[model samples]
Target: MLPQAAQLLNKIIKLDFQPDIVTYGAIFKGLCRIGDNASALTLLTKMHSAAHCKPNLVIYNTIIDSLCKDSLLQQAMDLFSAIKTDGIQPDVVTYNTLIRGFYNSGCREEAKGVLTEMLKSNITPDVTTFSILVDMFCKDGNVKEAQATLQLMTRKGVTPNIFTYNALLDGYCLRGQMEDAEKLLDIMTQNGCEPNVVMALLEDMEDKGIRPDIVTYNILMDSLCEAGQLEDAAKFFSDLVLKGLQPSLKTYNILVKGFCKKGLMNEADDVLRKMEKDGCLSEDIFLVMTFPRHYTTAIL
Candidate 1:
């Protein structure tokens, strides 16, 4: 469809009807969307040579983004310089695209340098900018730099979002900084970020051979329960036992309370019976026994 549109534009141009910048921009975007950067660049050149229509910042940004995504970093950089030479100031999007490109290409220093140049140009880095930097640093195992970037982000008044915390949490977990990860998790909860947002981190932990302790399981179960995923929580409990990890009293309490809260008396009773079988049914069960009548019926 985009190619057909481009052909239509060519026919219009042949008849001396020059398409406007908006028309050219749409075609450029479509071409870039399909990774046809070659055609997009050709159209950009033709647009530049046309007497009435010229490429704007948006068109240039689109092409630059495509080039970067295709890992044509040098071409993207040349176009970055070209945009400035054409008297067009590169916006935050332009810088961000290049920065992400450099990072994806393993040019960490170049990525950082782009951020520096962006600051020098007085383009205020948004949360996305900081989040990208934090994610890059964390993936590179430079959590210290990630931490510094986070601090700078806050100092610049860009509040950290879930993505920012998740990246740092992943970095800490990757480095076996479980204590720090737990502390960060606590901070996330304190800051009103949902624990379920970091639930995927459990897979990362397993992949990295980081044995999740009882506390970690408790957090996972609690998050699952809070999200109303009682079945998943129960499966995780079974997994815990299969993995030879003893379910603590708190673990049983989380599942029992989660089931009872959802009025799942049978499921809650099953967990209680299992708890008794494991010799984990103690007085501490009352702590999570919110439904006294149901608890009395189950225990009896």
Candidate 2:
């Protein structure tokens, strides 16, 4: 279907019918899905030259996503530079893509720099911006940076939501700072913010006032166990029970794995048994049960 679409695009190009930004973005996105990033990048250049039409934020985002997936982090940044040189002002999506791209490419400083640039451009950072930055900083063993970004969010009047807390908690847990993560959870509750950052950001602006969400509880619960903080994990689970939110099977599996990591077979067994009793053990979890010293040591 993509090849046919590309052929159709080429035919359109030949007859002097310039495809709109959407058309180019569709073809560019298709190329990304098929793992032909190099061709996609080249085609992007071709589109620029042939039509002299600047690609929109969507097309740039597609290319940046493809670049990040292809491990071309530097190239992605280079394109970010080109985006401006080519007279394209990046939107919020572009900033998130570049921030994540720099993050995945092991360019932490540059990634943070992109965030600063976004601020200078007056492009308001969204939850995704803070979430990805938190994840990147935390994964890179920069827990303080993660915390600092949260502070920045506060100064900017972007209240920390669950994703913000979950991300910070995850970072703390990853760095063996379970106590700090728990403290963050406490702060989240005290601040009257929801647990998940994504929903928190949306609910504030979503015309309809549906504020009920469960993603933050799930992330924090899962992250706790994944980081081997079983006691805290269980505490969060208990909290979930109190809140009347049914713990999904995925949640139970996370606790079990956490117990298993701490070599507490008894606790793991008990958690699994309870999950079965609750009739929530039907789903499969891709549990990375093998505890590694570090999931990534590439963070510079």
Top-TM-score structure, candidate number: 1
Backbone clashes in model 1, listed as residue pairs: none
lDDT of 1 by residue, 1-300 (tens): 999998999999989997988888889999999999888888888887889988899999999999999999999999999999999999999999999999989999999899999999999999889989999989998999999998998898888987888788778888988888877766665565655565666666678777877777777778778778888888889888899999998898888878877878788878888887888876747443455675645544
lDDT of 2 by residue, 147-228 (tens): 8988887887877656666666656655666556556654664565433442343334223332223444556665555445
Query: In candidate 2, residue 216 scores what lDDT?
Result: 48
Off by over 4 Å in 1: 1-4, 154-163, 186-196, 207-211, 286-291, 294-300
Per-model root-mean-square deviation over C-alphas: 3.7, 16.2
Worst 10 residues of 1 by lDDT: 286-295
Off by more than 4 A, model 2? 190-300
Per-candidate Cα lDDT values, in order, are: 0.84, 0.70
Against the hidden true structure, what lDDT does model 2 obtain?
0.70
Q: RMSD (Cα, Å) of candidate 2? A: 16.2
